[model samples]
Target chain A: DDEVITHAHGAGGGQMTELVDAVAVSQFADAAADVGLAALDDGSVQPIDDDHSVVVTTDSHVVTPLFFRGGDIGRLAVSGTVNDLAMMGATEPLALTSSLIIEAGTPQTTVERVTESMREACEEAGATVTTGDTKVMGSGEMDTLAINTTGVAVVPKGGHVPDAGLSVGDRLIVSGTVGDHGISLLSEREGFDFGGDLESDVQPVNDLVRAAMDAGEVTAMKDPTRGGLATVLNEMASKADVGIDVEERSVPVSGPVSSAGEVLGIEPFDVACEGVVVMGVASEDAADVLDALRDNPKGEDAAIVGEVVDDHTGQVVLDTGFGRRYLSPPEGEQLPRIC
Target chain B: DDEVITHAHGAGGGQMTELVDAVAVSQFADAAADVGLAALDDGSVQPIDDDHSVVVTTDSHVVTPLFFRGGDIGRLAVSGTVNDLAMMGATEPLALTSSLIIEAGTPQTTVERVTESMREACEEAGATVTTGDTKVMGSGEMDTLAINTTGVAVVPKGGHVPDAGLSVGDRLIVSGTVGDHGISLLSEREGFDFGGDLESDVQPVNDLVRAAMDAGEVTAMKDPTRGGLATVLNEMASKADVGIDVEERSVPVSGPVSSAGEVLGIEPFDVACEGVVVMGVASEDAADVLDALRDNPKGEDAAIVGEVVDDHTGQVVLDTGFGRRYLSPPEGEQLPRIC
Candidate 1:
């Protein structure tokens, strides 16, 4: 491990995994939890009784530009936790707790805007901000503001999904276009104009997930956030000890995002998509799941992008029509504070 | 409201209340919850079924000086959330989620020490760190580190206690000394040598609280963090629409803390106490509660500091031997990042 922490250690990549495993998982290995720190899943599950389990997830949002093109820190904070719970198959959150640490001199209007945005996001997800804490630091002691949200939801004891539940016969589906959030934020921060609409796809997709679950089985699920589609595919593959074969043409990327990624010298697959979910469905139910996802406006661009296979276990093979190549998990910090 | 936020807005005082009400409570006012954001309690309660309700709380730990005299940020983070759940009458935590936002370039050793401390605190509380998120900010973009911990617990329906449950004839009790945490940290930070074993009382007090609850009826409960005992007393008084009369001599302040408070010109009552609980118990059960608390090493300094009254409603009157005066909630930022 590196003697000092760096950007890579929190980039949701290989280094992040190493750091988490060395520090947290190793220390908390003995905790008795149904789906705990060791799983490295989107959330943790604790069976409350024989009938139901409690699913909880948390995220700290430190996006540099508090307000971006399509969302602000408030929306991002609420959606991030809500989506994490949804990924664990707890689509309807019971409650959400928000904790804000603001730097002195931040405008009251900024805080108000962020709070309103969070409320709107919660409404969209059918969740509520039930409790919260707020603290202010000296001006130079912190960046403008950071919001951390923790969400709790209850699901049937055996109904919750895990990122490691994929099998060789499962089909992979994506909720929407990829790379919009990271690329859009980067372009906005760097003063770039991609010409076409390049707004972040940072919205809560728990409803979309619910529709898909209602229509078909989702054996495994994960939100493509910090490390984008490539990272999630690799994680799902490696954790399940299966190979993921992705069709490059089937992975949707908007014109503006693709062009912006090209100009910024970043890969759409390696960046991030805040509102997307990469789900593994049973082969027999993939079409129904895809249909259900596409029926919602948030998932209009959803696609059946890949399938799990036995060969090349623990790797992701991307078929780009011309040739095939391995899709590796993102390695370092591609963009900081893009959450 | 101030056009721009200031340190007072996060000081757990009058300004902080205005900020939270204006920004969070009003925005989340319509959310349906058993003990929602409007209550401004230590935690919130959501009825999951006819028989069970879930309690959740979150706190963003931005305490400076990652390592303090008796506790570090890790222990503080876990204890803060655990105590919050305990205040809501949920003594056994079901799970805790930790979110770490670290500054780039922080030493790995520092992170390791903090993680270890957190594990120890969890073990003390009989809780587990089930899920978490890690993010890194650019070196100068954030302070060394900030940890946000969210705790969840389930209690039987109608079992949770509220901060506003106090009534006339209730006796107020302090589980331990008042100012150890805040005074110790200030002396350590400023190089003051108040060398009579001054150390932070930052430990999980769920077990202590459990013993108190098991012995007597605790009508209201709160931990004295931030604005400390004075602030919590004011909040409880105002919320419950009652007055509290405190015997100043009865509020326990250790010899070292008292000397430090005198030299530093800070009121021990106005600062923080991380491991102390201020409880309002029915008069008939006060002795039993005090006895139960004293049986625990952590609460050996427990004292019957005050009593609820009908006069001076929404106020806390202190009988300081020769003079009686109002004990106002601490104003402005007496201490920043103390918790």
Candidate 2:
């Protein structure tokens, strides 16, 4: 029998092996896609094979109480990396690598829990921490725990990457519920005490994105994180030099996350939306994109949340469920550290 | 014009941009390789071009008192990542990813210093922190901070990756003086009263590694991190199923570091080595490897430290200048956190 992960889990000994074998080995055994779920070194070490096809993006997580409600550092790590890869229009994230800066005096139990959670998250997303390094710091240097998860997703062939493909009047579709991840984090982070069976929507969205990609409907895709749907919209608009208009009612949000947002004086639209994706689809493919997104379990609540419009070029405006409309971007960086 | 890294600097933000621009921009401007020195994103999307090759390794850092000496969290993040890549025989590392777990109420200033230091480290190593996430925990939940830095290095064409390439009768060479990094970190980490110019040799070893690679030296290279030169030699022997005999007289140790180690009950041979590389070379190419390593600033102290003999398979024994011999890979892990 293998030893369980303990304070000595990070001690580079037998227990660490047990922790990795049990939690990591099993979870990523046969991931859903071709991402580097298994069979690689410390991260993705495969040599570079493509040319002129690349995308880059970055995000940070400052989940409060370090962890809470339903997830911890590891889950957050996988989802965080997967979302970044998706944002790049990378088809399948082949591998992930993590760096941990742990505060001194943290119980080994917490570290093991986080590692196990990361394994689960990676398995769900079809990626793994192939390579990594660790360092320990003294007390009073950081919050309880902060995980830096970075992922490398291979851009799908035949699908247009973000840099080269875009046009005006594209349809904007988002899979599933919005604001849940953020609302949950806010609720747990600040002790807002939102009632009902609500937890962070911090699950990996790679498969859902894959489904959408497979449907042959999207021009570009992104996951709404730290800056929320509004900021992501603006970024796409700026990058593609297009405009966006959204019917707020068409976007889905769970009741608890919504209620929690209102109580915290935060806008549900600005809350983080993990396990969800926003895609720029050709006008002709709009219907297919929505259908594909809604087909998945996590995307069951999908909808045509907005459309790419030339009038609001470089702008993201949301039409209220009522009649009034509100400008979204230019408000700048909503919910810092939401990631 | 604003400085590149901003709120994202603290948040892993716009300030992160300024930092990268001022430093890493010129080095890793490529889309796939550089994710922005922000350490906000994961390593870039690298397409797999070949099969049947993978290299894996882990490193740790335990800068005492939790932080300080010369470098901080951020600096260590890059140095650690780049160094790992170097040991893997890769000249160019795509990106460096990291994680952070900080204690409650850690000073913002200290965090900034470390982050800034990391920026410098990333730039120097020609590596970037493409992706990362952070967290904050409750009071009494963590110490200062701990970091884990993971790297992925491309295995050069037709060259044997580290773990698989060694053979019997190979000569052992070290890039520079041992124990400097260990003692420097010890002095700074503990704030010992006896302070006499102990500089941390925490520089990126990628360039030095490149020098060796160019020299076309024979098989296997590694950074002597947590367990020091002694441990890695033992590990190599064990993994390759060979025997290694290192001559203590040939292994260089700075006078001060040797003296410090004697006073602290530390074995200089077992102390961590930063900015140093230990490589196994075929007897035919030993001189080339040594010359290449010595030509570089970081490896100027390079020397022929020992040889891999056939008999003592899976073991490493050091013959000190005196008649006494000490077993390498001492019974237990030495310096638990000396990344």
lDDT of 1 by residue, B32-136 (tens): 567888999999998999999999999999998999899999999999999999999999999999899999999988999999999999999999899999999
Please tell me how candidate 1 rates in CAPRI terms: medium
**Model 2 interface RMSD, one decimal:** 15.8
| Clash pairs for candidate 1 | none
Misplaced by over 4 Å in model 1 are none
List DockQ, one per candidate, in order. 0.75, 0.11
Q: What lDDT tens digits, residue by residue, belong to model 2 across residues B82-169?
A: 7765665656765454444444455544544566676667667766544333433434545555555556544544443354356887
lDDT tens per residue, model 1, A1-339: 459989999899889988999779999864556688899999999989899999999999999799998998999999999999999999999999989999999999889989999999988888888898998889988899999999999999888999999998899999899999999999999998777489888999999999999999899999999889999999999999999999999999998888888899989998878899999999999999999999999999999998999999999999999999999988877788988
RMSD over all Cα atoms, model 1: 1.1
State the C-alpha lDDT per candidate: 0.92, 0.60
In candidate 2, position B46 carries an lDDT of 35
